[model samples]
Target: MKLRSKIYLYSSVLFAVLLVIMNLAIYYIFSTLSVDNQLDRADAEAAKIAADMRRAGSEVSAPELLRAYVPIEGMLRLYAGDGSGPAPVTSAAEGELSTLKPVFYNEKHSEIIRVDGRSYAFISIPVIWVDGSVMNVQMTQSLESTMDTLGVLRLVLAGTTVFALLPLLLSSRVLSGLIMRPIVQMTATMREIKQSGKFRRLTLDETSKDELVEMGQTFNEMIALLESNYVKQEKFVSDASHELRTPLTVIESYASLLKRRGLAHPELFTESVEAIHSEAIRMKELTEQLLLLAKHHEHWNLSMKVIDLEELVRDSAKVFRNAYGREVTVKVKGEVKGYSDEAKLRQLLFIFLDNARKYSDDDIYVSLEASGQERLITVVDRGIGIPRDELPKIFDRFYRVDESRGRKQGGAGLGLSLAAEIAAAIGARLSMDSVEGAGTSVSITIAAGSGE
Candidate 1:
């Protein structure tokens, strides 16, 4: 789940729990107050009924007197003096009092009762007679209305709980998303930098004065420092390689002259001269490849314009044919026009053909086609295919699939790296799919409308 959703979920749950607790507490407090009020009212009514019973005369039947009593006159039930059974009662009858409390000065005056899930307060008052005797006058009051009110309150509380939490849930989601958006953008920018070795410019709104913006700024600074160091290092390597090439070429020429002068035996002279020449040629190729890579990396800029990729491939194929006749076969298919550097595209295409001639037999397939948003240019060679493990590293600088074999084949192993740099400069992607025994296929996919 996203961060926003998780925050909203957790906050909603917490608020719901708190709302329930608050509602329950309010219900308990209100219920207690209602019960207390009912008790006080019931006690006063009991005392009044007791006085009325005395005035009605002690000689009358207790049930009759209770009937005549006003306060306890209704909803009052009287029991026999001996506590044996209930006597005749009416709507005026009050429920039984479990204890003898009204006549005893030290006894409790009132008690609580429950009936049908409703609470009530019951009180007993002493009815004093002329003969120093007493009668119990009991009073009762129903808590039905209070219970109903409480039920309504419970519903209200539940509704209030949900209503209060809804905004918090929504706010949590919105706030979490707002907080993480900058971080997500920064993450995407860093990924682009890592993939292409290019720095991105990021702009954060002023209201977003959070830690994520600070982090983005820090990351931009780091990329700037890395780019500066990388440029300096590439320049140094290119300069050193170029400077060494001239002297090495002169040494090879002088060695060849020594052998031609017949100063040594024929076999020894030929072998020594050939070794010097081979080393010199290898050094020269290495220097050239390094210089090309340095040039592509130095500025991280490509002069792009609209170019016909099919025509560009055709021209490169003709150049290769003129240089090495009939050794490689080049085929073009479908119209592929995109924005790219014409010089760099030509160089990239030549690398494919060169690889084909170096490692494969006579048959090489070059095909260009457009699909969806991408234009794919593929170069397939029926040569000694790359191993599965080495294919991934083929585009790394100076990485050779067959290191020992590549040196003998007069390759410095920088062709694919240079091609990859060209592809990145044009916002194209390069991919190679190959199997151990199967011929390798290198595909370059440029945006349909991207180039020159």
Candidate 2:
């Protein structure tokens, strides 16, 4: 069932139970009070009859006394201490008189008995005469009238309860709908988003301090982030596809040329083979770079340790100097110690140094400077520096300011992207300063007490 329906059902059931209890309680209390009042009236009537008999002082006959003391809407009977039958003062059935015999013998002061299928309240009083004889005065009042009144009350209560339930259920349903309206809207909005593949936020009532409002706000923020990530993912896929197509087309062309005419023209065979080899190498490098970019985007798995930043830079500079047969100057201003993933830091170093070597013919400078609460690691080279307008896009995947130069240097344009990702993953800031035709300087800032 829907939540609104369930709320209404449960609430109606509870209200129905309460109504039943209240009706039963009212009937019981009213019935008890009515019975008590009837008994009191019977006692008062019997007292008046006894008083009249005392005033007469045995001078009046039993029939005359009963006639004189007859009560309104009631029956009266008198019995002697002798074994004589009762004297009737008011008209009553013989069976009813017989039913009263047991009550008299039992000496009960008051009782309610059914006679001839009609209910009666009987009150018995004993009378003492001056002659030492005893007499019993019995009075009875019909309960049928009071019972009819109660029956009417019961019917009225039952009818009221039945009529009240319709409005109760309807009102409960309306209240439940009002309560669940926000959730219903949220569900519809989610369905629309799923169908259209669009990120749309929920318009909430800002004045309401309910949890549903908070949930709507949070959901809007989550969709915003997902949309941003989706846009970036689309761009990455487009760039990767464009980068892969050229090398693949070149390889396929060279392979086709070799297969068609290489055996006939031995001179053409060498050129075709070389072209195929070069293209294959390019494809291999592009594939590796794409895999690296994908891996860094997914999750960072760091093996953190403390290392001397100065020593690490010196080691990387030595490797660079040996590999390129060029001088790599290392300058340290202080003892730079940091806690970081050593392998990832080495990879970042390789990217910067390799980029410097590929672009610049001048000697490379790797510097580490420590100031208050921060350490700066910079790679400076006198290269064909990036244009100011192109610098912002340099860290974008497969973006190259000089595409031909990058191709000649075997650069897939992923080194700076990978470096930036690694720096972000390790909680460092990577920045660059370059002047076209003068030099380029790339620096990574490591906060003091970071990565520990």
Candidate 3:
């Protein structure tokens, strides 16, 4: 269900419950008040009848007739001591009147007396008679009028409850709609953003003063960051690809010359062929590394498993020793075990070892160790160390500390960048420490277990 409809339904039900409780309370209170008033009026009428009886000397005197009339009043009766002789005309049969007792003083009493198959309230008050015998005056009234008034009161209360609920229901719906409109609009806008692949600002009015405004502001900031990062990534890839094209073209041109000229010097041809093959290989490696880095940036899933880092470093050192004609030393200082992709981990170790060889003076120290709960792999080289200002840009694709020397050494400068990508993909931390003209130490730290 929509938020607005839910709010409306919940509020209306709550208001209706309160309304019903209030109406029921009022109905009960008014009904009690009406019943009490009827009884009080009945008591007053009975007292006046007794007073008139006291003033009259005779039982059938005219003074008794002076009693004030009461609404719903019925037959009046007079009783003497011993309770049975000379009863009034409206008195009951001898058997029924035998239940009456003598009234010696002014007192009030009541009973529900049934006669002729109907019920009546008999209100009796005591009075003093002239002959020293106590007499009682009685009057009976029907409860039909009070019951009728109670019935009408119930109808009025029900009518009031219904009328009150109408406005409550209407106001609840309006309030719910007003509160929920901004949220609904924000939801629609987010859906549009997902479908369109571009975020647009939420244009809710400033009059909305609640969490919705805060959410809109946060969404705007998030989109701004996404756009900025996307632009930076696009620029980086474009620049890296552009840099490779020139070297690739040179290699292609040399290959075409060799194919066309068909060995002019024989020895010279062999040298040219080697140069072309080396450049082609370098271009291929650079392109493949760049593509891998791009794929990593776009969220490549690297399957993680426990691998022996000590063995990986030892193997990488052997590869570099053969490839670069350098004396590489590998030391396994501790048990180096962590979760990572085996192939990618080997690729990363090779990148670091290759970079160390390309810059260092033939002696490279590669060590893998475990300390506490962390695995540390360090590649240290006593080479022409990077300058302080150039160290920060070393991880940038196609960046080099000594660009001329790097090109002379046949280096493309993407090895460290690829190493950094691999480190990030496997949840390891890669950092470097260096001193100019002395040496450089590159350290990669991987946590034990899954490296979270």
- Candidate topping TM-score: 2
> What CA root-mean-square deviation does each model show from the true structure?
17.0, 6.6, 8.5
Off by over 4 Å in 2: 2-164, 175-210, 261-275, 296-301, 371-374, 384-394, 401-410, 433-439, 447-452
Tens digit of lDDT per residue, candidate 1, span 294-393?
Answer: 6745475567877888887777777887887744455665667877778877788888888888887666777888788777888888767888888778
The sequence of per-residue lDDT tens digits that candidate 3 reaches over residues 91-134 is 23323432444342356687666565544567877666677766
Writing each residue's lDDT as its tens digit, candidate 2 over 418-452 gives 88888887777899999999989999887664653
Position 377, candidate 1: lDDT? 84
For every model shown, the clashing-pair count is 20, 0, 0
Native-referenced Cα lDDT, model 2: 0.80
The models' CA-based lDDT, in order, is 0.70, 0.80, 0.73
Pairs in clash, predicted candidate 3: none
Model 3 steric clash total:
0
Each prediction's TM-score against the native? Answer: 0.45, 0.63, 0.59
Best by lDDT: 2
Cα deviation of 184, candidate 1, in Å: 2.7
